[model samples]
Target: MSEEKPQRKIIHVDMDAFYASVEQLDNPELRGKPVAVGGSETRGVVSAASYEARKFGVRSALSGVLAKKYCPDLIFVRPRFDRYKEVSNKIRQIFHEFTDLVEPLSLDEAYLDVTQNKKGNPSASLIAKEIRERILAETGLTASAGISVNKFVAKIASDVNKPNGQKTIGPDEVESFLEQLPIKKFYGVGKVTTERMYQLGIFTGADLKAQSLEFLEKHFGKSGTYYYYAVRGIHNSEVKPERTTKSVAAEHTFNENLSSEIYMQEQLQAIAEQLAKRLKRYELAGKTVTLKIKYSDFTLQTRSKTLPYFISDKGLILETATELLYQERMKDSVRLLGISLSNLNNEERKTVVVQLRFEF
Candidate 1:
């Protein structure tokens, strides 16, 4: 008989309204008020929204104009990335205290593998609670956590009881917890994918599990296999300590739409300069340069060109972006301009796996 693999304990931790919460934590008067981090009422997009603003449908990626329309009293604060980074570093330090097996998804969230940990704690739920308490105490911030046997379930569980809360799906409960979950709640299933699943009559994990691997692959391609395994609580991806930077980009939203190629070229020049500076800071270069254009009506389009060799110079980026700008006729008045570099020079870091003895 084959030996059954031991269940792994994973935890996903996410800060509550990280950017907006940081704003509130810094400014005592902003507490309990609707706040948005980034963007202006006249132009730009909201990077994050406080829970109060969320009540009015204010959310990240929402246009500032619509955000203000949703909450007339919404207060817009410029994003202070440095401050947010400072807080993020503190939270990461706290995670390292428990386990070195941590994978940060963003500045506000991460996945931790504590099946074997520095604290020698057997109860992942208790460890999650303690880590949250430490975050609250150290950063004056509230965090939510999900504890489960794998990253997929842990990530989903983190959102179950959000904003200073946590939930754990133990090994014995993993299958049923996933079976009853809404299909949309699966981590990688976005709006388009959810709609596709809905059309295929896959509304819940149970429905997904009912489909054959061949059927799922036929519909979702490689992702079909993911769905087949995920619903069975079979995610094997580990919590990687080092996440790769897939791309680097810089973008600007104009206060007014630009109709002239000359004006657009000028904006791309500035964006290219910013992108180059960022790439230089990281000591990275890329062979692919992509131009992102957003029209006044919010229709998005992208143009990309691959070079013979990697380049991070502003002049080269600007030249390529300029070519792309004039490559196509104006679809509509351009409202946003961006430059991005991909196929980066950063080397892929390999992960080392370790065997652990599970106590739970």
Candidate 2:
């Protein structure tokens, strides 16, 4: 009798030691040597270290001093985020070749649904292999990929054979894989949760599966539901492409509270200048400018002004802020002053897209 296979196909691709690997790709001399990319001081930490460095007990986020202690001859390099971003865009373009449903976890990691892909490749494992080969060919860097029927198992599979390796966990293998998984390896389980799990004698996936849902909920509160479903290899959350800015605020606490209008105006101008810079950075223009004032007595008040058109200009922001500040009737010095711009633009259109997430 022929058995039917499940129809879901998911792939999780993670660049192995992404930042460090990118550094090695750019400079041929740094390959196969202990390389750490981040700061170069006692106060700094390693953001990423090469596999060679990892051999000497060095890792990302470790203090430079500790890393040096492990490998005295370790080389530390500064991170060039701009260059990293350029390479990331290149990698993303490569992903679009396989599937448009790519959900980037960060600059280095992403999930792709290749069940009905643009490439017309029916095998998810083959797509993952091709993607890895493409990434190495295009960027001269190595990446690890996991192929599975769902995102959860695929993410775990990617880490199983890391650093220039690929893994696949089919529907039939997920049960055994789950039984052997450490509870700490489960997504969303942090250091504190892992410690709590250990205290509760929940050391592995087997232990977690043995616990009652009510016990998980009682211990973890609202997030208990997540723990329960994770053991069963289920995650219903979709990858969200559009991220909304709830609010944009520019605030500066005064070194000293100001009673004089002249000083307050000076402060507002500086804040508006900062606000303008941020808006331009995000490629957004705001229609409403709100002023926040905290008086010496700790009482707070706010006033807002809406414009006919979206703007990110410094002069316009300062003018609007000054007018709103003037309207606030305050008899005391202000300890804090802030300017917020909201009612964001959508698709470069003048029409405002108010976040339904926001309540008036």
Which prediction has the highest TM-score against the true structure? Answer: 1
Model 2 steric clash pairs: none
Please give the lDDT score for candidate 1.
0.92
Question: What would the per-residue lDDT of candidate 2 be over residues 1-360, giving only the tens digit for each residue?
Answer: 112334467789999999988898889899888999985657568999999999999998788889988988888999877688788889999999887777787789988877667887777888899999999999988899998766778898899899889998876677678878998888778889999999999999888888888999999987787777667666544433343564578887776899987789899999999888778756788899999899999898888999999988999999999998778466899899999999877542132221111110
Candidate 1 Cα misplacement greater than 4 A, ranges: 1-6, 251-263, 273-288, 292-316, 323-337, 343-345
Tell me the TM-score of each prediction against the true structure. 0.87, 0.71
Please give the TM-score that candidate 2 achieves against the real structure: 0.71
CA lDDT scores, all candidates in order:
0.92, 0.82
Q: Pull out the clashing pairs in model 1.
A: none
The local lDDT score (0 to 100) that residue 77 gets in candidate 2 is: 90
lDDT of 1 by residue, 209-305 (tens): 9999999999999999888888888888888998889999999989789999999998888899989988976679999999999999999999999
